[model samples]
Target chain A: MNAAPPPERASPAGREAPRSSVLVAERLTRRLEGEVPVTLVEEADVQIGRGEFVVIRGPSGSGKSSLLYLLGLLDRPTSGRLLLEGEDTSGFDEDRLADVRLAKLGFVFQFHFLLNEFSALDNVMMPMRRLGRLDADARRERGLRILRDLGLAGHEHKRPSQLSGGQRQRVAIARALANDPVIVLADEPTGALDTKSSGNVRDILRELASGQDRSIIAVTHDLHFASAADRQIEIVDGRIVPTGTMATLEAAAAAAKAAGTQTGAAPAS
Target chain B: MSLHLDIAFSHLRSRRRQTVVSLLGVVLGVAFFLAVSALMRGSELDLVARLVDTAPHITVYDEYREARPQPARLLWPEGAVAIRGVKPKAERRGIRQYRRKLQTIDAIRGTQAAPVLVSQAIFSFAGRDEAVTLSGIEPARMKGVSTIDEDIVAGSLDAVDTNPNGIIIGRALARKLSLEMGDTVSVVSPTGNVRAMKIVGLFETGNAGYDEGQTFAQLTRVQALMNRPNVANLIVVRMQDAYAARTAAAFIERSLGYKSVSWQEASKDLLDALTVRNVIMYTVVGAILLVACFGIYNVISTVVLEKTRDIAILKSMGFHARDIRLIFVIEGAVIGIGGSLLGMAMGSGMMRAVEQVEIKPPGSTESITLPIYWGIDQFALAAAFAILSAVFAAWLPARKGGRVQPVDILRGAA
Candidate 1:
């Protein structure tokens, strides 16, 4: 589905988002109350267009995961607005937000988070059953197809406890795509994986984003993972620091190290 | 099955031991409920049956319920007729036109009626005197109306019909007076007309009082001795359906103008006692089921506590709070219903065991088994209580599970 771009260089500007964008965050913020109040995401603005793989990269405690959660409609923003296909979601109630999450967006957490009681096939069918767009047999057929496509065909009956770490994560992804949501959000998708498994997950995610024309927004500290995305938004403290390309993210990480500050993760080095 | 039901099954299966233990609570509770109710109901029915067997269903006495109005008061309307502190004329005390009233009573369907000439008499032998209640009955009609036929241990009731001067006395009285069959005793009515009557039949009703004080004789003989010819004092009735006695008695009193008392009216205190017993039985049995409900509540609350993260994940997966609640409620209902079915079977067995216990009451010569009433409604009652307890037990934890926020769990796990 990635027809070669029509020869004009893709614009680096994100603020003037086109109508084809899937999710838009307009200066969204999230605040947590405590003895000492915390701001998880502060005034973050980003636009994710269809068929794009976008990354939010930062150091530890940089609020990248918080921003991704807000964009995915898992959490209500403290101020500013988020739009899904140009509909403002700031006023949506909790149930309505869940409906949006079920029908429009999907999620993969740092842990696989598959229900331990269910088998891999049942896990994949959970979202489809919830959405109720398909009957039981059809849901089963579609779930098997998704699992088979992700190379878990024979492992359909295996419980989450029986599957390897990477296999479990793939089951989680299969579950997320069960309803064919247009936007798939991942928070540290490779956070619990080994080197080779994380590489496998990254490649699979890249293919799913571009090959199917589905937008993917993921948060990670892995610079190598960020460099593969079409666009990257860097977070420092709670605010987004925009970047133009893979080169800009590499340059920023290099500059941080030279200036004696913690840099974005570069596992490849 | 629905998805929530499937999930509920899985959750219970995962904690099978805990589920079974809670289920045991319900099973024992329901079993005890059925057994206790059956015993209580069975004993009540047995007591009423014995009561009905011993007494006439309805008794119409010769006496008027109210004093007969004087002719002067009847004739003087609004004339300020005052007869205060005046005694009525003491006329013949027996019922007039008694043969006609007996025929009227016999015509009433679903009843057996017999006229009896009852009088207080004294039996004297060798200068020893004893008081007795002489009930002179028509042997054929008495056979149909009175349980005395069954209590006769020696000669049948027909022996008294054969000999005009024959008397059937209870064994206790025969023993006390040292009289036997073919022995003669002088029976003197309260008005002093006396005759030497031979004992032709002997009966022992296992009631010491009735055996000692009550005796039976031919109706003609008692009427002659009492100087109450062509008159009877009581008409004892046995109905086809004992419960219909009140209405029958009322009709009899209204038509015959005699005071007809039904067994139910005669024993109001006994019926009231049975009703109070039933109330206490239900309260104690209901408390058993309530404790079973608490067991269910404890188990479900623990399941909710242990599965909080799972609930959070389900909520995050677009499951509504109600769906989560439904899963746990279904779990509770499953256990409750399962336990009820098992308990019903066990309770039936328990009731059978109870029915086999033999006890001879005081002063009884033979052993009798306990009465067991087997009513299907007790099963329904037990099931209703079981399901209600289970549903209510599930509701508390279900509401808590439904209100769980995914964000809270996710943040804590992170």
Candidate 2:
């Protein structure tokens, strides 16, 4: 899928979700098996549609990342069905699920997780090669273009170890966008970056959802990053808690909206 | 996919030192395997050829497998007949009408057959008398079955045909009887038949016992002296394919009612020894590759352990478990191909060195080069084994890589 146009600088239009949903899930649950059986995600119903920047927020053990993984098709739900682009994925095998993820979903983990052995260009070429729509030359050109767009123009030949933390994360973002997936899933994209790099990463993620027409789902505890999203979900103890009881989160969002600024990380309790 | 190979090669190239260390194991294993296999098989084949060449490929004797039943026992269907001794009507002992049997033997394809009369006799020359085996043969036909013509040391085998009363004796026998070319020797057969024969040829076959105890003469003269004219009691047959001797001999025996024996049957113990030697060689060589496989397993398993995050990342990036497995297997294939090619070259070099080595065997003056077998089958075997071991070594870690769950690693890292 082609990326959406640059996000409008006008009033936010993400709360109105009645347009079209790219991914739909019903009562999805993931339970770990052991002597002490633990449930990671408990009957979570969610919808991620076009042009929405959704942030998953929770305490340390709230299964926020688990929910994102379930939605990203990296983890299978124990007893619920997931629909991707209006196709049922409940019966898809491992390989088929991977194909769907490759074609439809992109992921950016907390550590940036760029393959250390490969150059920035090759790392971005991975997903494009997996899709196999373009020949090698086209894939390389597409890879270089994505890197250039992400401000990694001269660093294409540098490995992850040679690049800075922010550059590496940008390379990861470039990789996520290589195949032009319908949705991007980031498990704390700015979790390990400094304040400056974290701000740059947050801005990049926001533009991805609002401007590029591609939906984004990120897991984060940063109140500032959470407040900038079109929608914020708070998960507590493997369950999604309603937004009304989370006063600090609501307070942060309202204050950031009133100030007309992009960050809402003040007064984090 | 090329992606798999691409990743595989990157992994190997990233860890260059460990890759070389692991590669050397397979290289040495394969090289030693080829070198040792060449030496063992080369020597064994040389020994077998020498043994096989020294005797006729197939020999047919004039005898029935079992004697006929007594007349009384044959006549009484239900009665028990006991006899202490039994004798049949008098009959001639030699093969009757052997010329006709020779014609039937000559009709078979892929074989050369010759008739011979073998009898024991005592030889007397000057004042010495020693027992010897006198073989009566047609010189023209005997050459097809035996290598005595090539081993002729003093005179030619063809001289027996031109000389009317010719006898070919071994050099050791000539020394024992003080007989040389043109010397007449006296022989007394078992039936008291005596004859004086002129020695026309001499042969030396490197076997002291055979050289001292065997002699050859014209078939017609032997039959006349032994009082069994126009008869041959035995036939020696040689075939183009030594391995096909059993079938050919079986055909001859079935058609002629004679006891046919192939060289294979006569030297079964020696052949069995060769088979046992092969088993031992393979087991030892297999152990070497197995050890090399363990070395590969160690290196790849360490790579898997170290690169767990890379595996998790690739899995999260939408790579299938099969892709992970293919990457590791490709790594193994790289090692297999590289090791086998270099090992064969190194092994060929070792074989050349071995071929240049000279040794003087016991009881011989001239130094001879050591035997080295160079055959293509060994190369194929070394390569097949190298690849198999390499693939097997990678299996454990590849499976581990395929089973990697990105969430666990991510959770742990978080």
Candidate 3:
């Protein structure tokens, strides 16, 4: 995989970011302290712009999900600083961080982790309820609208167990947009979905980024899914490895689609 | 209504069997607690009522609580000289100025005092003699201060006033001496005076010793027979409130300079036993609820364990640790409240069942029902303890659940 190195662009960490950037990370590192210390993410620098769709592509155990977690404010970094919308968040307490996450960030995991006891609409309304910014009627209306936009209008009252793989993934995507977050973080969003569900989830995330002006950061091993994003970040051994731009990756993916062949085996999807 | 409670209800609904089992434990605990405490408090109050009714609320004796100081000792402050082996002056063993003392005692609010001249005597009928304590009483005054009138088996206490030579003896004494009502018997006093008296009444107090040894007659007749006319040695006081006896006795003793004893003071040992019994009763009942609370702890702990993944997801979605804790705690509180309400109903039923029990004690002719006190305090206490225990049991596991780090669980699951 380490062939002729592509032209190195100026690292976003060293240069002044544009006013549209929503999340900026400067050499963020996370290490698990033990007898033999392990580094999950090492001095990683990332800058995600508003309305941008970015994908973290890497081999297994390469900290692709770890970086997503740090960016989502789900885990604190060992040594570096992160700024969300020009606000320094390294000094915020656990409760304050949770508040920021609730107000500004959303998450979609591989398993379509909807509460089993609640309906699809109820699961979608969980974030809105937690944020408490909207009234009950407003929350219900917004949840229904989001589910309807995701082509799940009639299945709003159905449980995750009752829905198909593609439908469940769509419900999860609807849940991720419940609070109309500034950014959505996805960790292997389609890792448990079939090919059709994976394509559906990728297109929905792409539309959320472009149409609603919400930034999206997803970690995936599927090259075809990565090709749909505006940018791709490759990581190896906890370090980001610069890769080809969106134009080249899209052209390659289009050719692969025409030939009905995949360039790489998808992991757990 | 709130989010945490909504989540708690959903969790409990998902595990209906376990929730019902824990709830039943609380219900049984509260029911048994109410029933046992009701019975215990009932019997204690019954015994106290009997004690108050059958005896004087306060008794003023002819003797003093303390001996009088010697004149020399009073005159010489801090005297080095000790008065040794000093004997009290001999006089008539009776309250001095009995009319004035009775008037003073009766002046106290809610109190009624009756003067009695008690002396030892021997009753002889048909060549058989029995030693008994003879009481000289005015029927009108004694009626207010004693329940002896209510214990009469034949005739009445007023009959003594109608016939000055009339005497009232216990039924057991009548049986032992082969005496009947209206029978003439000779009463001999320690003063060497003998007189013939007619039995006007017979009483059976249920206490064998008291029934066999006590006899009452008209004041003038007994005073004249004993050769102590106009001398009353004891004043028995009955009060409206039996519980006020202790303070009343103290006040009366201070005023009259005589030894005054309350029924509570006389039965201190029995009352102390009852208090110890109450402590044991509550501890045992509380322990039953405590054991039942373990069922709550088990169910909540299992929920926390099973819901770790859900907890992690909620935390990632911005639910705080306290919110997570509140969800589980609400689960505990719901069970507690539900169980308490149901338990109170069950306990009321149990108490009603206990009230139906009747028994005939040995040597007693009539059957008596068990005393079941229906005070509201026990019900409140049982419910409060059960709910508190249920909440407390939930607290430990809730704290554990709240402290669960979302990152750890998320990382492991991923």
- Candidate 1, residues A1-119, lDDT tens digits: the string is 12122112233443244538778889898999899999999998888887789989876788888888788887788899998988999888888888888887778878899888899
- State candidate 3's TM-score: 0.89
What DockQ do the predictions score, one after another? 0.44, 0.71, 0.59
In candidate 1, which residue pairs get closer than 3 Å at backbone N, Cα or C atoms, i.e. clash? Answer: none
Over B244-349, each residue of candidate 3 has an lDDT whose tens digit, in order, gives 8899999999999999999999999999999999999999999999998999999999999999988988989999988998999999999999999999999999
DockQ of 2: 0.71
Model 3: residues >4 Å from true position, as ranges?
A1-19, A244-269, B69-86
TM-scores, each model vs. reference: 0.83, 0.93, 0.89
| Clash counts for the predictions, in order | 0, 4, 0
Tens-place lDDT digits, model 2, residues B1-414: 988888998889888888898899999999999999999999988987886688888888877666767777789957987877677657776677888888887887878888899889899888888999988889899999888889998778878778858889999989877788889988899899888889999999989999999988888878877888988888988888888898988888899888888898889899999999999999999799889888788888988898899999888888899889889988988888898898899999999999999999999878988788999999899989998999989988999999999888988998
- For every candidate, what share of the true interface contacts is present? 0.33, 0.82, 0.62
Model 2 misses residue A123 by how many Å?
A: 0.7
What TM-score number comes out for model 2?
A: 0.93
Q: Largest TM-score belongs to which candidate?
A: 2
Candidate 2 residues A1-269, lDDT tens each?
A: 54322223222555454647888989999999999999999988888877788999987888999999899998899998899889999999888888888888889988989888899999999988877877899889888888887888899999899999999999999899888888999998999999889998899888887767778999999988888898888887787877744666667778889989878454544
lDDT of 2: 0.86
Candidate 2 residue runs with Cα over 4 Å from true position? A1-18, A248-269, B67-91
